[model samples]
Target: MALDSYDLYVVIILVVAVAAYFAKNQFISKPESTGFLSNDSNGGTNSRNILETLQKNNKNALLVYGSQTGTAEDYSNKMSRELSSRFGLKTMVADFADYDWDNFGDIKDDILVFFILATYGEGEPTDNAIEFIEFLDNEADTLSSLRFTVFGLGNSTYEFYNAIGRKVDLKLEEKGAERFAEYGEGDDGKGTLDEDFLSWKDGVFDSLRNNLNFEEKELKYEPSLKIIERDELTTEDKQVSLGEPNKKYINTSVGTDLSKGPFDHTHPYLAPITKIKELFNSKERSCVHVEFDISDSNLKYSTGDHLAVWPQNSNENIEIFLKAFDLNDKKDNVIELKALDSTYHIPFPTPITYEAIIRHHLEISGPVSRQFFLSIAAFAPNEETKTKLTKIANDKSKYAEEITLKKYNIADALLYLSSGEPWTKVPFEFLIENIQHLTPRYYSISSSSMREKSNINITAVVESEIEKDKRIVSGVVTNLLKDIEINKNKSGDKPLVTYDLKGPRSKFENFKLPVHVRRSTFKLPSSSKTPIILVGPGTGVAPLRGFIRERITQLENDVNVGPSLLFYGCRNENEDYLYKDEWKEYSKKLGENFEIVTAFSRADPSKKVYVQHKILENSAKINEFINNGAIIYVCGDAAHMARDVQQAFIKIISNERKIDLEKAADLVRSLKVQNRYQEDVW
Candidate 1:
């Protein structure tokens, strides 16, 4: 109370020093705690417009995506939503396509960039994301101030699996961008994309909370669907919108690159199925002969080509899928799809019914993966069922025994594992989000383009098998073809069960099936009179048939036809040897120029023989044909028969020329390089 003025001043200085220290720590300091950095309201600027607002409010975020088929776009959207919903941060999903590097270096250091990249086509950049990748390769200095995280989607079967996403992660790190959380890669081949993504996003959110000093919010699924009911129509007519899409969007530009075109998983060309016939009377396997007419179309293909068939979801399976998703009542609801790329289109009738989506869009043929089992496990009706699902998801051996190895599709697997409780509680969006789109099945083009410019022929053995556990699995496209053939034979007397081969969208309706030409390297010699040898088994004789037809047509025009030798085989000659009548016509014109040797493994009980055995039997003539510069072609099973035939050729060359095995193998390799030895095997 009686203190002097000097004592009072000393007390004031101490108080001022404490206040300055507290203010500095609160405003300008970094926290020691590790996790998602808290949002710096002042530094996290997003775009130019966001930056102006940020100068007033705070910083913003950046959304980046490297999508293979638009899945990453969906994920990026999800991330943007989470950033806004949980952190109260302003966010916008940016396509890597539209991003520029001019001011990237000048961006605030606290700006968050989220990357959702999907690996594709042996780790090659996706068509839409390629431009962005090029920018990254050149603009290392621009990203030095940025903070980012990456999640890659990929299949493991490919050698360079997830290389695109992994490469981007490395490049970003090299450019001095700091990570928000550990950048991760998800394997779609193992079906861990969803789980891996879910776990990674949670870590990212946690990091954001701690590292950025942002407050955490509860995580919840925000419904993206808008449901509307039409009173004029039945209950099935109620439309559900996944997300609002631009209805007036036009598709005017057409893709020119046939090989890498948009004719794969997302969008498929509904090529016509022109001609189909049964090749065998009695066998475990059914040989399907089909010719697709491509004369009026701009599609061009060559011999030794493969036709890609865009298959439909079986009606029964579609119904099952609808029931599973609890969308059975609204099966006919119409919706349009919107994608960032022209190559990625809606995989159905444009603005089509929901039934069309179930029937033609989703891939319902394959076995369900464990990740799917885990995702839906929470929706299980009981605790016991949930535990079982969790176990299956965690244990590969159990999953194999109970799901994959058992070869169970979604419906059957759910029914069996869940004790037949109807799985109608799962959302339609979940199904659409999880299941992959149906892809086209490739068929070897059996007909030579030189012989029939208007028609492209294909030969396929309809695949069907019964699992050990008594589940019937049918090949999707082949069965679709068979059903189409049966309906055509009925002459419209009855309604089709699965399909009308000549469906409404099928433009080549006059022809039996939809087909497009695929260019390939398999072809006959350019010389009209060049001697040739053909070795094919089963329906593999398809292209060789085209070659023979070409020779016959040329001979009819008085062109010189050289010696033609064929070694064909099947289970039995009377059963599965294809094109019996056509071969007769070919023989008539070619005479000694045509040689047909048939090997029927089941025709004789004494011993079984194949085309390779037949070739060995006639080694002398084969050698003569080979020495005369004859082109050799082999078509069949690539994993076995083609390999066996190749080895047999080596043996023949070794013995005939009296050379060692190495020398004989070298000769074969040289012939292959020179195009004298060619193969078209599946």
Candidate 2:
């Protein structure tokens, strides 16, 4: 029988779809054997019997991930697994940075490309995905045949929220790529990054099934790599297994030459911990105040800025990581790595020991992923164990409620789920390949450059708690800083927690922390002619203090000064209030130009009020400041405090200016786009 043009077109499309599926599975299955490029080494080969038809059809679905931390990469891998196991689709999760774009235009029309892009650092592309971002921005025309979907991760509090995701979506469209589903955006600020992704992804999967006529494939256990034992090693040999590369590398060494500009992603300056104090007297919940000395470095900053601190895992956590990866015996073994591309920078310099890897390279303490569970299934000691691991990995609701929602890290999760099998069998290479590199954390620069140009100050609340599930949790950076403080403050006797006091790569000697300044748009009115209202509670006062100090310095230097008002809040006046005496000097210089209100939530017999209440009381003056071109700024917690303060501002505009709710909202929105209403919330 002769075929018509319409029939021929349909046949071609089906052929292309099948070919794409096979190509995807061929790329994703196994590691070196598959030629698939990924940062993760846990590449498992799916069972041939389960996916024979899909493999034979040669249909490939491309999954690309732009990950900053490992979350996006992990999610991409999960999607790839879902495609292969559930819908009988052959899929590969391509690392966006590593994927070649030259032939994107030639992709099979039936092939579906999934993009998991994460926004990092003021909407900038992640360090590993920078090239991919630049490519899409510059050579978007190359994606004419691509059928794609994108999911972006970002916090709404930032000015450029999910900017990379939005830009990628727009750029791809401009380049002629057809989107299969609506581009998805997940807000980390709203604590719904996971839910948003899951919800959006369901629709995407449904679309793929309808478009391609995909059928479900039963899942089976697949182990990426194997853990084999080497015999004939004694205790002494095991002690030296990590080799000599690690012995010479001290954590503080990375920043030894900060005076000379060797500072980069891996190497950081070990600035001295000049000062440390508790923001509150209460032992239950206390914030740590810290100061870093940069008198010798050329690092300079303004009033509103951020300081990125390079941190190391605590020795206890390091030990836990080594044990979990089954590398404790080879604690001193040396290792090296080569990046496939120039853009693939090692998290840090390698040729180091297991201890260094544990302390610096691996993000060993994060929550476990389904992929992790699936990867470890084959390594289970017995059949029952394998079934249990597989169940945990495959069951989304069970995994979420028992694992992710409970905030369980790998070690605790393994212990709870595995019945204390001791996780001493997981391989070291698997960890280095699967887990993400530790990234630097940013803190608001609480000190003003005008007040102390050569110095930087930071405030953080130490997070240590026993949750409802009875799991102990600690903030990685804050706890590390606290340990440093304790070590420095120790007297003649040995300190309680011995953290190898010197960091890996010798980057931090004398327990000084590594830090670099990151600039912020949340700045003072450049002219100083605009009156300003500042509302901040607790550590939120950090940047506001900078503004106050900057304005004070400007007035002293014969610069024009404007009226300034600050509503600062804390638990008590005598304890948690920061920059107390400095505010007095600041107020004296400005006179009526400066107005300060203090709210002590735990001080009075009437149980404590907050800064939002204080704003309502002084609604008249606030209205006057607003009318006279006042720029309002709020800094602190976005979850509750920032929103409450925002609501208070809306109320002030409505009650004091006697405007309708809608008009008041418009005024706030206008101020927002004008940069007059700024927030530096985390």
Candidate 3:
């Protein structure tokens, strides 16, 4: 129909353009999409099918981890590497959310599976493991030949400690899976998780050798990853990840608006810190009340939700880690990482620099594991260093005295062991494999969502402890927050530690932090008419503040709010009492409906008074509230304070009701069953 040559040429060009667009959309190859900077899978074709994945990789052992805060995943990786290196087993680490469990029972009898699961709050499965738990509970096939082992990571402070892990082990056995080793539980409450894991791992290895006929081979240094220097690339290269969380950030324009929807643990929004203030008056300690602006983002949080703040390692710690590994000179040099095993995945995005990996990826500030010492001993600079590392790794008391008690990180331990000599012989791949990826820190939201729908508030106490050797042990996120407060306010207070507040490419220049909200079951009653009792001490009062604020909002709205009682404790009235003035204002608004009882632990030097003591002192009132159908909420230190408070309540109930201790405990259990008693302890 085209009569003229010019018209025909234009028509052909348009036709080719349309064809190219369709081709790019349907046929052109693209990099596989992954969870934000995650390397959980190797991008294999059979990644979604557990049985097919194992068969395709020819793996004899599979380790599946259900992790909420990366600990379980870290342990799974460690075990996987040890299995491959020490026993010549073909092992693969799998995330619970990555694969389908429908065909899990179809795996061969030769392969052994290990479940490294962590129990989340209130004995619930982790976010990633919920589906897998449901599948095991509701739909599963029996396979008498399948063999497995389970090790649970939990805090003993919770009533249902290791509940998920125990359930998984029991379910597997009920589904006709053979148990190759005894179930193991690691207690974080006692600060003995590492030792417990090591002890259980030794027993598992023994069982493998004795029963499974797996020979224990001499441990050899076999790197699972290959690191290549990307000399052609620079920090300015768009392909490089200079602490950018994911490829999207690296590819997007600097001025692009990225704070959009679907923000979660993997993808976080960079929210600006709109307000910051010091909450404590003590020189020795510092607590900060900080607020974040999320009006421009799609992030929403309830009053009792948690905010996960992703923090970067301090520049000092990053430099020390690089120097220890002899990577200081090439801190900014771009490098590409490749996994040696097809089933193994590199933990972070590359081409990244040593500095970025240390600052944004690795947990460089965490304590050095004894197993790490044993793993890297083969690459020690000298025989003396190797022997010392081996001895410490084997001896519990010596390891605790030298490493645990001193709180020495990898860099500090290396420097001390080598007498200030850098560990130049250690492979960078080994370090990546041994150290865990940095996880986000969670804080209770201290602001009511109804009052401030778009602004999230959190209160935290900056943690800094001096070891016996005068080495300062600082909390990673808290100190980062402290530095942010100092920098933002332009205050005269000297920061205990410094951080690169500007962030990568100056994206976080104006007091911005990467944050995501995690929904929690810890919440107030559905109706404002339900009476409540809040027990919080120190930073534990964070959520209690939110509860009070919610009631205040309801009252302001002329809603019939119920009576509320709060038990607050601190070191002293003039020192570390958090939100002291705010309480007075809240009292004015709520009037007789709200009451606060204070306990100053250090007010009297001879005796240490705490919130539990105050609870006992107000036994009559507490008993009355209980009788009036008041819900009790406890938030604070789970190791001691929360436990003591619960005991005091039990004592009050026993005295008030003229019941035996067992009967009072049973009543408390019944309350918990009815969701009248809740705890948000750490």
Candidate 4:
């Protein structure tokens, strides 16, 4: 029997894993399928054998994660690394969705369990963790023998901050699970997620050491994988992957890997940009309306779903990183990496090139973590460079000023300190171990699934600004999107952003990019008769547009509709009012049933009118709608607008119902519990 290309790739990876496992202290090639590589990590028949696997591997700690966008999974892996290296505790990372709940309570008493969960949209569990949450909710086992700790990852901007994590903590306690340490919460809203985790882990370690009789060792550098450069095979070789994302995209001469496969985050569809146009009239900034042709792909999305755009790093940036590391000469040289330790998991496939690793796998743009800075300082070109890095790492005050305040990423920091010097002494494996993986950026789908089932639309405001240092700070995905809009429109003008439009091997030459659909809880009411009140400011109107478009389709089908009000806020109506003509068309179809209230803050009014002010102005009508079972939805900036809108609603309820502040708050909470007040805030 002959093996397919993907199968061959998998076998090669398995072989690497086995070889690495056998090497023990030596660096060898070993591969293990990681959760960060996909949307769902529970794929095989052995998924339910978590307990058996733990015992077989002699692991004492099992880190289970419920993640939507890989944050929790990444944290889980980090915990695994720390546990295995520093505490001398054998650990295994597992997806919550993989194990069966029926046997969840039967796990051995010797093993410690850790839950690193992220509360997603509207306080809902992630798609993969849904079944697990439900099982925990339904099962009646006491779980008396279970010992666990939980750390929640959530945005404080949402009403239910860390709701899933809170639920799990309470439920586990109720089921008699002993908690060794106080549970922690990491807030993404304040941009202190990493700092919060690092802080919490120290307390957790103290508790673990006290409870489990554990000893902490001095932190030392441990190499998990060894990198071997192959000079024989060049970039032109058939099997060489020059930044191709997956096995199906390897571009072998035998034939195309036309198999559609699963259109999940792991295996994305190369969706073509069917149509794109600038939405606003302003020239200084850009907000593009893009349409993707998904007819040939198996990616299905609802009206309020999100589209994950896999972006490519700029060629100039990749080159700068290569040169900084003194690897520009051997950019295409094939390298095989093998894990030296059984606990360490390879993030990506082995036998890839330096260019592919730098361009495709690693996140080269983000600001450096304090721990990462400490790790890389040891490999600095000179003692002076090392001293400077060590100073920044040791002095918390200086770190906040130099790294955080200045927003210096790895490349910028390295280039600034070691000017004209290549840090060639840094091991390739160390770089791979420290740098984070490049993940996809998600955008709200702005087109109705019904109006254009095969075509998905994305509305994004490009984030590009000239920093104080005269350096351009830009978003990777949004800049890529702007480039696509430029290519489609044939705008000969100087672009606000630029990109290497020709992707790996020109796979994305025709403005095609890898994409996948992520179903969101932010959706329109199932019934057309259900009234909806939408509050979306700026590009937050992305999902609201989809809702209104669906309502338009329903009206076209001659179905009865209810009151659908949209409160959209922007700086000015002339410069950035979005979908103006389309709203007018919708008004014609459903005369009194549809209305769009525009709040133009910069229309040169006597006062700056905002979305919350508009909501308050129509408080009487809003309260009436709420009394009549209307569903209220809020989107956009979660920190300010969403918070203000919620307060405005609370005030309306207080005045309308003639209740006290406490009672009004309870009423609002009830609405959220009933799913009447939903939010899709960022």
TM-score of each: 0.64, 0.76, 0.93, 0.89
> Clashing pairs in model 4?
16-29, 16-30, 17-30, 17-31, 28-338, 29-338
Please give the RMSD to the true structure for each candidate, in Å: 16.8, 12.2, 6.5, 8.7
Tens digit per residue, CA lDDT, model 1, 435-478? 55554576777777677887777788877677786666767888
lDDT of 3 by residue, 380-471 (tens): 88999888888888898999998888889989998888887889998788888788888889999999999999899999999888777776
Deviating ranges (above 4 Å) for candidate 4: 1-48, 98-102, 251-261, 341-345
Tens digits of lDDT, candidate 2, 263-311: 4333345678888765666646657778898888776777788887865
Best-fitting candidate, measured by TM-score? 3
Scored against the true structure, residue 286 in model 1 reaches a CA lDDT of 73
Candidate that beats the other on TM-score, 2 or 3, i.e. the better one: 3
Q: How accurate is candidate 1 locally (lDDT)?
A: 0.66
For model 3, give the RMSD to the true fold: 6.5
Better of 2 and 3 by lDDT: 3
Segments of candidate 3 deviating more than 4 angstroms: 1-43, 253-257, 468-470
lDDT of 4 by residue, 1-682 (tens): 9999999999999999988777873553222234444311122223355676677667799898898877787788777777877788888778776555667787767888999999997788986688789988987488888999999999988878999999999999999999987899999998888878777787789987897778888666667678787788777775666766675677444765443656766677888898989888988878999999988866788998999988777665676788778998877789877666544456665567888888777888767778677768879999999998898887878888887777777777787778658889988887876777788888989999989899999999988777798766667888888877877789865665567677777888888888888878787777889889999999999899898888878888988889999999999888898887888987897789888999999887678989999999998999999988899988899889988999999999999889987888899989889888888878
Instruction: Please report, in order, the local distance difference test score of every candidate based on alpha carbons.
Output: 0.66, 0.69, 0.88, 0.81
Poorly placed runs, candidate 2 (over 4 Å): 1-70, 73-113, 119-143, 156-167, 198-258, 262-267, 338-348, 369-371, 385-401, 404-406, 467-471, 491-498, 604-608
- Give the Cα error of residue 567 in candidate 1, in Å: 2.7
